[model samples]
Target chain A: MTRAELLADDPLWLILIKAVVLLLIGPLMTMFMVIFERKVVAWMQHRPGPNRVGPWGLLQSIADAIKLPFKEQIIPTTADRKVYFLAPIVSVIPSFLAFSVIPFGPQVSIFGEQTVLQLVDLPVGALVILACSSLGVYGIVLAGWASGSAYPLLGGLRSAAQVISYEIAMGLSIVGVILYSHSLSTGDIVDAQRDGWYFYLLIPSFVIYLISMVGETNRAPFDLPEAESELVGGFHTEYSSMKFAMFFLAEYTNMVIVSMFATTLFLGGYMAPWPISLIGDNYLNTGWWPVLWFMGKTMLLLFVFVWLRGTLPRMRYDQFMRLGWKVLVPVSLVWIVVIAGIRAFRNEPNISTSQILVFGGVALLVLIAVAMLIPDKRARAEDEYLVPVTGGGHPVPPLDLEVPKPPKRRSLSEAKVARKPAAVPAGQSTSDTPDKESE
Target chain B: MSAVLAAAAAEVSTGEAIAFWVLGPVALAGALGMIFARNAVHSALWLVLTMLSLGVMYMVQQAPFLGFVQIIVYTGAVMMLFLFVLMLVGRDSSDSVVEVLRGQRLWATVLGIGIAGLIVGAVSRSLTDVPVENLQQQNAGGANVNNLGKSIFTEYLFPFELTSALLITAAMGAMVLGYLNRHEKGMKRTQKELVEARFRGEYERPSPLPGPGVFATANSVATPALLPDGSVAPESLSRLIDSTASETFSDEIKSVAGTEPGPDAHALTPSTKDTSTTDTKNTEDTEETR
Candidate 1:
């Protein structure tokens, strides 16, 4: 029987067990991910991470989880109390819900009943993931607005813009995968990749998805919403205790969900590697073993997430936005058109898929070269508009590239003598002398 | 997509019926809450709840593709933009008790009922006119999304293309409206102009503003800076802070004791001579304000 048919036949108690397992996976993975990320980041920087909690501070997240609820919950005086309290809950539920559609493995026998290792599989599982991630932003925006503070409000607005811009690119990237897979369901997408992964086939879409997933999860360079240096904890600036911990949990959980999602979409989901799958007539790819492979690929992506955090600095807001709208969105659009062209050509009897891909690749490269050769009008305008060395009304120092010449300094004795009216030059008034000195 | 309509037409399954019963009233309550919520932000949140429930309702109806798109487009993109604008404009930009438009509330109630009636009528007409078998025929060959795609490209092609054109126009209009002119005269002054203006004495003092609580008794913000000649420097205090030094000038001086020069005392540091000029400047400022 197909996985869906098997899933449909699950008993009430078994479904309940599946639901419970799905719920447990989010928090459990989050706990492990938190410590793992910290340890990895610490290692990258040549430092020992948390060592005091459990064996190498493994119990730290659990202790934190215990401590969070007991800590004082601070509500701002000017806060909209109802929405203020609701935001974190709103944020967390969607992150967990998104995980429900993620296929962990192929059909597995659980307590002698056959079922897919997923909580749910809708016809549009891909869109469900997108929808859930989209819904997740509301929590952030509402939290920022309800805080009744400037920083949180700014943070919320930023996140809203960030999500909206990146979501287009993200959605477009998935379209290429959906086109090849010929199905919106996550399980079907994974199944379609039996021969080869979409990541390698649709390289451009893969790269776009990789960049966008980071932006979607608010990780690393794209983490402007919670930029501590700028907005002082961004949207969660006013949240405390359990409320704050919930947001933290939601963020880490989102990280896991997106990483797993990337794995499912691009790394062949729960399928074992080529060598492992080759053994025993594809034995490792089936049942419980696939779950191990799924988790392994997910961890690899999660490590990439951590590695990015350790490597890149947080991007400037304008540059980040430009990258999303100007670079990622346009590139995704072009890539989609190219994919559509290739897909169209695949239907012709004379053309092979490989030949079409090679032709399309060459054409795209030439197009890019031509595009690059053209000078940017905006850049030329900027070059023509010379910036003044001295800061205008604002007190900005001169740009580092153009150092201003220093004013001539008088000796201390001369300065003191110049301060006296009698020692001042005959034509120069004492007031005028001070102004000259100042200039 | 027709599969969704077929599911609606068929005998109500126990699971779907249960879901409908659970979510139906929640969606109704959400709509009501959106209208009645006092705060604008709260109203937006209420609308979000309504949108979420509607998305689930679509899912429960076996149109999961439509369900997710409803969420992705409406709840995610559209309403998010709504909230983003609301946050930017003002959280409190809700309906005011004082009516700006005459009979607006009455018109709103009437128009709202009219729209609801229109919707009910339209839905009922469609249900009556369209046969379920035809919907099933449409649903025969492909998945719900594929059916949707086929219909959108073939039957609804013009409308789809029109919608895209409309969207592109809207986007272009937005771009035009938001465009910033870099070269407008008096838009931005050059650094050279600012420096020259400063040297010309057209700007305020070149020296930094004296910080609050400088050489004061309490060393708190409310305690204004004391000048070299035992006078309160008004510039040192933030307008937000209470002017405690000005109100209890003598008391504050006494509190600082001999550390501060007494008002009547003539013997003081050399800086006292320089402050005598600024002391007159302060008196002039206060007099002008008075």
Candidate 2:
């Protein structure tokens, strides 16, 4: 459908149907995301995953969904009743709301009326998604706070720091897309990329967007807020049954939302890939085919999410913060400047690819020069702290920690020195000889 | 009269009208709660509610961008920082109890009432002039993101740029002030000294074992002693009883603490035997908590 037809008036029933579908997608995708993540990660680890629940474990997530609601709800006695109860609901609602603005396909006929394949699409479509994500953090922070526990509180604090740092990069990275597309609306972005996907042209922005999306969704490596190893269950440590399930569902829905956003912004939403579009004079790009392509792209990105989780270890919190603030943000800012310069230069009649190449080469050379001049303290520090791991000897964990150490083997002479001889009476004691004398 | 009657078309749907009424009051109540809540986290939660209400209000006004910005920036990021501070600093009642400024509460009440009265009076007088039709046309039509962007760039460019500069200056000022206080604890140490101090065994390492080590992983915080064969041996130095499942005396349980288990260790009895053991356990638990 053309851009003009996006906001065409729809019957109330159609709106309701669209809304219902939009809402259902979140829970359904969440269920699918859970099983998908487990299965994919299991495959990566060379293990069979949950195949017991149903045919090839297809019904596992569904079974989990059925089980979660029936589980006994637990509320900590120390928790503030109102806020504790509201946190998960608060978290789940924004996740659903954020999905509202993401367009799945072009205008289509629905019950005799022509409309978009998805729910409402705002002018500030991407921004609405960002807002919803930001709002979702409250559920987590509140959950941690109302639990009146320590680890959950730490998890909450980590989340606050993480989202704030990553969001700047996330927001700035999208700016490049807006500048290229000349519109904030998602549909406009897709239409703008009909000829070329932004993933190829805006490579740096795409890379940054990908990184930020991982961080934004709190997926593995960047999932410090819910890092099980560090904080037990993190912010949901005190949550149980349905409340915990809400948090769990919210996380997966976020994964889907972010994946879809990445697809829409960089991968060309709903548009079929190259060669596929070449089929039947571009029949693959039209009609209901676009929706299929949209889902296909999003699921592919979601697989990447699971792939990263299975392959990478969680980052140290400081490392994560540094990556977001020091690396991603500054790099994107410079790249954005370069992109803006390129865009403005392209508007000129005489600009050529050769001229842009010259500009890029010069920029690269300067960056290298600057990097060569800067002192690397971290490298030196790493060298200083490095220790040889020899003959089962290892660095000691803190006294409070419970690291196991094996007993040392002793030579014959050393064993004699180490073993204390049992206390021997100078003469036979009464108790020692009593049993024999009595017999 | 006809013009007024015909203007009903300009109004939002009945559902939206009801939502507005409900959300408005909820927002107001949230703001009030933020002011009067007992705990700091509760206050932050109330502030969140207020921010969400304001976001909905912006959406009602046909400005989705502003609404989203309200939710994303104010409710999402800002209040999260507030909650973080509250959670990290802990539930210190002294934050509310000890008034740093004398007569602060009285002056706050006065100023608050005066501002509320002024706002109510001003809004009551100006409410009639707001054209409802323009808002309806804006919402029902295409995205107003372009219009908002155009106005900000063209009409209010200077103010926008000026505000950003102002924010930068404030941030710089804060950093400078914070940096000035860094040396208040002591003279600044050399990098070498800082590194040495941080890495020193006493400062960096934990001093004593929490208990006889029953578990260890390379990634875990706990460190245990090892045999020549690289198998863990319990230290048998713990003052408190280890109650881990591995310490249970059942067939499935091994003596993780290196203590020989008695026959009665696996069973729970409610007579003299259980009570005497429970007495000792209660003492140990009390000591542990302390």
Deviation of model 1 at A93, angstroms: 1.2
Off by over 4 Å in 1: A351-439, B1-9, B93-117, B123-142, B188-290
Model 2 alpha-carbon miss at residue A18, Å: 1.6
Cα deviation at A162, candidate 2, in Å, is: 1.2
* TM-score (all chains, Cα) for each model: 0.78, 0.76
What is the per-residue lDDT of model 2 for residues A1-439, given as tens digits with 9 covering 90 to 100? 4553444466678878888998899999998888999999899889989998989998999899989889988887888788889889988988898877787888777767888876665667888788888888888877877787888888888888888888889999999999999888787888899889999989988999899888887889899988999999899999988988999999999999999999999999998899798899988877788989999999999999999999999999989989998999999999889888878888988978898899889988999999999987764335554333335644333235565776676789987765644344555553433234434
lDDT of each: 0.82, 0.78
Per-candidate interface DockQ score: 0.28, 0.26
- Stretches of candidate 2 off by over 4 Å are A1-6, A350-439, B1-19, B92-94, B102-125, B128-143, B180-290
Candidate 1: tens digits of C-alpha lDDT, residues A199-296:
89989999999999999988888999999999999999999998998898899889898888888899999999888889999988877999899999
Cα error, candidate 2, residue A369 (Å): 6.1
